[model samples]
Structure formats: C-alpha cells, structure tokens
Target: MRLSDKVVIVTGAGSGMGRAIAELFAKEGAKVVASDISEERINEVSTSIKEAGGEALGILANVAKESDVQQLIDRTVQAYGTVDILVNNAGIMDNFIPVGEVTHEHWERVLGVNLNGPMYASRAVLKIMLEKGKGVIINNASVGGLFGARGGAAYVASKHALIGLTKNTAAVYGSKGIRTNAIAPGGVNTAISGTITAPNQLGMEAIGRAGSAPMGEAQEIAYAALFLASDESSFVNGVVLTADGGWTAH
Candidate 1:
C-alpha cells in the first residue's frame, strides 16, 4: 500500500514496461490510469488490474497529440480529483536509420512520441500538481539517451532530450514540490523492437560493435519505476536511473 489513494497516469500502458508499471502501481494502492493509443490493449490491461481487485481506468490516447494529452489530464482529474504521478512511458523506436538516411517523416514521428509527448503531458499536469504542492514525474528514457550507438539518430536524440527535460523540470519545480526523474533502460523485452522491420546496415553495424548485453524484462524496469513513483524515492529527483544490468558499464 505504498501508493494508497494516489492517482497515477501511465502512458503506453497497453504492454511491456508501461503495462507492468500500471499493474504494479495499482497493486500498491494507486488508482491507475492506463493510457495507450490502442483501445483493445488498454482495455485488456485495465481489465486485468480490476480483476486483481485494483482500481484502474483505460484511456485511449495518442501521446503525440497535444489535444490528447490535455484531455488525458483533464479526464484524470475529473475521475480522481487530482494527479499524484505521471509516467511518460509511451515511445516508438527508429529502425536503426542513421541520420544520413533517416527520413523527415520518421524523425518527426519518433521525436513526436518520444519527446513531445512527455513535454505536453508534463506541461498539462503541472497546474494540478503545483496546486497540490506535490507530484512525481517519471520519464521512461533509454540507454540511447546516454550513449549514441544504442539506437538510430532520431531515437537517440529524442531520449537524450527527454532526460534533459526531466532535469530541467526538476530544477524548475523541485522547490514547488515536484520531483521529475527518468529511467534509462538498456535492452528490455518489448514489442518496440517489432518496429525495426527495415534495419539500416550502418546503424546495425555500429550497435554490433558495442556487442550485446543481457536483455532485461519489462517488470525489472517497472520495479525501478515503482521505486521512483513511491515515497521511497522522495529524496530523489532529476536523476537518470540506469537499469540496464550494467550494459553501459564497459
């Protein structure tokens, strides 16, 4: 019951890390808002949580859209009265396309979901959180945010920017009772890899040079996120908690 009565919004909650985080939060007594672009997936997660005797609401949302983000927050407040935590977990991967060959469409799409989505959600939630004088924001960043060769150009750039945004938000709102942090996961077992249908040779070669690291489970990252969302991490803020099993150590 670490998060008893707390209202948490988790984006990309249909599957993988997001779904794990959403379910875990609910188990800890949080009223979870599971948001995703896919209605079917959202319903599945939400239903599972409810079946477990936890509170949950499934919201269909495409985080890339500003209007969607606004509506998400508005609906959460309407349902739960206020927001306590926001997890920006929705993201897409670039198909290992280096900058030289990356298309404008692909770049924009990746950045839109990975970066702009978090920005919009954070901006919208600040009003409620500021008034409450306490809030937590956790961004699901990646090792790509810390290193270059982990992903394609756009994906790397977006995650890097997300970490930056996390720090900046913490700095600006820390004293006002807001804690913002990020999780830089290495290789997690998620459907996001399915997006890489057409891999770029150079990009793949660059990653191959780094060698392979042990793949992590979605629940491991979810546990890390759970720590961030709970009071255990009250003193932590603006930190990029790397949960990659030391993949970047070497």
Candidate 2:
C-alpha cells in the first residue's frame, strides 16, 4: 500500500486508463475520489472499488468546466479531507479529421477538454497543495504531444499546449514541494469511441510500426503513476515521461 491513507483525485475514472489508474491507486491503499462525466459509470467504478475492499467516492464532473472542476476538488476534500495526488486523465480526442477538414467547434471542444481541463483541475488543487506543502500532479498527455499524426491536428495541438503547461507548473511549483509531471503514452486498448476494431491487431501493428515494442497495458502506466506519486520521485519534477512503445525512438 504505497499510497495508504493518502487522498487521491482521478478524473475520467469511469473507464480506460483513468479507471485502471484509480483502481491501482486504491489497491495501493489510497482514498480515491473517482470522477467522470457520467454518473452511472462513476458509481459503477466506485462500487467495484468498494467491492474490492478499497475506499472510493464516485463524482460526476465535467473536467472542462471550471465550476465542475472546482467541485471535484471540493468534494474530494470533503470526502477524504485533503487531496495528495491528482491524476488529470480526462480528455477527448478530435474526430480524426485533417486540419482543413476540421470544424471550429470540434477544435474548440477538443482543446477545452484535453488541454484546458487539466489546467483547471490542477489549478483547483494548487492552493490546497501549496497550503499542505506537498502534492503530486500527473497529467496524461499522449504521443500526439510529441508527433503529428495524419489526422490528429487538434489532438497534437492540444497535447503540445498541455506539455507547455506541465513544464510551467513544474518550474513554478517544484520549489514549493509540488511535483508536476506528464506521461505521453502510446496506443492502449481503451474505450475510445469506435475507431479501434481488433484488439490483438492493435498490438500486432504496434509491434511492427513501433519496431517490436509492445503497446502498453493500462496497468503499466498505472505503475509509473504510482512511482511518481510516491516519495520515490520526490526529486523528479517537470518531467514528461514517455511510455510510448518506442514510437518516437526512431
């Protein structure tokens, strides 16, 4: 139980990497506040955690909204009294359109959720963390942050902006005992709304395109997150740790 007795807030905890991260943290003994836009999914996650004899509170929150973000932090504080770890995992992808083909609405929505959402959620906890004299913020960036794919202009833009924000926070807050970092993960089998067809096909493609490096499991990223949250990475700050399956190694 690396996180035993500590409080954690995980956004987008209803599914995918967020859910896996939340469950892992709770298993390691953290009191987790799991929030998602959907109340049903949020409660389902909470219930599963509780069934596993872990502590969790389900919250319905839209990470892109300032009010909702604030409420997320507030509710966590009220439930577990203080937040020690925050996983900014709530983000939406662009509809895989070229920049010329993308609508303004699509771009704005993607940025709002993927880039601004992390900013708002991190800001919400900054004061509390500053007051407590220590905290960890983990922003879930993507390979999109580092490379421009064929039709991920909006995703690329948003992630690049998020990297900037991550660096800024780490630089500004490291001295105050706050460690801010980001993870750029490669393809993982998650519920990303219908593009991913075959599961093993993804792994096969990853192995080939990424040159034999396997596409990571959500648990792998969760392990990295656990390390970052622990005192193990106390000296580490403002780092963008890439967990891509050697995608950018070339």
Candidate 3:
C-alpha cells in the first residue's frame, strides 16, 4: 500500500478514469474523497469502495464552482484532518469545433469546467497543503495540451493552460514541499467522447489519425496517477507524464 492512509481527493470519481483512480487509491490504503457532479454516480462509487473494505466519502460537486470547490476541501479537512493528494480529474469535452466556428458561449463553458475547475480546486487545496509543508497535485491534462488538432480550440487552450499551471505551481512550491504534475492522456475509452458534437474538417482529420493509435484503458491512467500521487514520485515534479500510447510520437 504505497498510499497507506494518505488523504486523497479525486474529482470526477464517479466514472471512467476518475472512478478508477479513486478505487485504486482506496485499495492502496488511501482515504479517498470521491467527487462528481452526479449524486447517483458518486454514491455508487463510494458504496463500492466501502463494500470492498476501503474508506471513502462521496461528495457531489461541480468543480467549476468556486463555492463548491471550497466546500469540497472543507469537508475533506473535517473528515480527514488534512489533505495529502489532490487529483484534478473532473473535466468535459467540447465538440471538436475549429477556432473559427467555436462560439463564445461554448468556449466559456468548456473553459469553466476543464480549466477554471482545476484552478479552483487547486487553489482551495493549496492552502492546507502549504501549511503541511508537503502535498501532491496531479492534474489530468490531454495530448491536446501538448499538441494541437486533438481537440477543439477551447479544449486545447484549456489543457495547454493547465500544463502551464502545473509547472508554475511546482516551481513555486517545490521548495516548500509541494509537488505538482500533470498527466497527458491521448485516446482513452471514456464517456467524455459522448459530449462531442459533429467534428469539423480539421477535427475529422485528427480523428482519423487517432483511429490508428491504440486506446488506453482507464486503469492505465489511474496507475500513472497513482505513481505521481504516491511517495514514489517524491523527486518528480513539474512533469507532464504522457500516458498516451505513442499518439504524440508521430
């Protein structure tokens, strides 16, 4: 149990990669706070963890809301007394609309959940982490963050900004005992794709290229996240670990 008794908060823990991360962490002896926007899903995940003899608390939260994010951290402290790991994994996908076709409303909404959500969560958690003089923040970025064409304008921009945030946080807090890193996942079999609208010409081309690459399992990403969250990655900071299956190699 590498995470033995560590307090971990995983956003979007209701399903997909987030669910995998939470379950794996609990199995590894972490007290996990499983958060998601869906009450039903969150409860299901928490119940499963408890049935498996693990400690877990499920909270319904819209990470894009600062107030909700604050309540999340406050509740975690109330239950666990401290925050050890924060996994900013809750995110949404935008229809693969090109920059020229992306609307302002869509852009704001996408950035709100994918970018501002993580920022809010990180800010709320950093206060407690800084006081403890040690903490780990693992953000779920995308290959779109590393390269264009993987996502629409808003999605790509948000992830790229997220990577910047990860690096900056690590640089500022590494000396203070906080480690921040990101995981850039390529194509994973997840529910996020269900939100995609019709693809544009550029998006279609990217999709074609993606079709040749192998899709990774949610557990594969959870495993990478687990390593980054555990003490095994104590010396690793400000890194964007690409969990994609050679999607970027081309």
lDDT (tens digit, per residue) of candidate 3 on 1-250: 8999999999999999999999999999999999999999999999999999999999889988889999999999999999999999998888777788889999999898898999998898889998989999999999989987778889999999999999999999999999999999999998787777676787767767665656999999999999999888889999999988997887
Candidate 2 global CA lDDT score: 0.84
- Tens digit per residue, CA lDDT, model 1, 77-146: 9999999999999999998899999999999999999999999999999999999899999999999999
Instruction: Report clash pairs, candidate 3.
Output: none
**lDDT tens digits by residue: candidate 2, 161-199:** 898999999999999989999998877677754432332
Clash pairs detected, candidate 1: none
Which structure is stronger by TM-score: 1 or 2?
1
TM-score of each: 0.99, 0.91, 0.97
Ranking by TM-score: 1, 3, 2
Cα shift from native, residue 79, model 3 (Å): 1.2
Best by lDDT: 1
lDDT of 2 at 9: 93
Q: lDDT of model 3 at residue 205?
A: 77
**Predictions in order: lDDT:** 0.96, 0.84, 0.92
